[model samples]
Target: MALCEARLEEKARFLCRGRNPSDATDLLQDTYERAFRAFHTYDRNAPPLPWLASILTRRFLDMCRQDKRHPQQQLTESLDVPSEEAGPAEVWAGYTLEDVWRAVDLLPEEFRDVVRLKDMEGLAYAEISQRLGIPAMTVGTRLFRARKKLKELLLKKAETGGAS
Candidate 1:
């Protein structure tokens, strides 16, 4: 409980990586409750924050699935109808943010962390290395590998017409 209280804000911010910013608070509370219920299963040797963050990540994915099933009507949807002024630009099939993140989530942990920090959070290699206690070169290398793997995954998804 004390650990949960101490890391609540940090976990919420992490959850916001894959969730609506406004829903962070509710998601954080949900994380706490779920964590408490699963406390007995927690490994004492494992670090708490990452474990909590993983739980929140799963919760965020669940919420995303839920939202997709019951999509909200957008007020700006009517404005999005194709207009005469819209040029015939090449239009690729749309992939939701969930699709992109789901691919990212499929990445190996070391690759995923650097990709998220550098690409999603917009951190520099030096900053990511410093925060993660790794070499800057390592950060760059991992990010490169991560992007390559992501591209492969997306390409495969496109080719197979799979839900990403």
Candidate 2:
């Protein structure tokens, strides 16, 4: 317990490497709460820090999976819809979520991983590099190229009336 407590902040930071700022607090809290609940299941012989880190990682992955499966929709409960003259919709309105998913899937395997980690999983380049065993610069470069390829694919789909 002492060992796990000492590494709480570090573990949280590790989990937050590429995620949204708003999620940091929740991730940290969840990690601690879970570790506390599972304390009895921990192996005394194994290193505690690593075990705690594993818990944090699992929690983060679970969140990502849940978010993917049930994406949150914008709530209209608090605001009136603006008149048509107010403004045009967002630029990405031309592409549906399914279209974006298909375009990402069409990317090469390597590029697809980078896109999924950085864009979908919201991982930081350093964290992605660490996970993939590549340099941070490589992660950045791959993400940039992946985005470019995805955009090109989406544009082509739009032109061909293939966007779903």
Candidate 2 lDDT over 35-65, as tens digits, reads 8999999998997888778888899898767
What overall lDDT goes with each candidate model? 0.67, 0.68
Candidate 2 local lDDT, residue 159:
65
For 3-103, candidate 1 gives per-residue lDDT tens digits of: 76567667667656533445678787888799999999999898787888888888878865655444321101211222344311111234455666788
Top model by TM-score, which number? 2
C-alpha RMSD of each candidate structure in angstroms: 14.2, 10.3
The weakest ten consecutive residues by lDDT in model 1 span 72-81
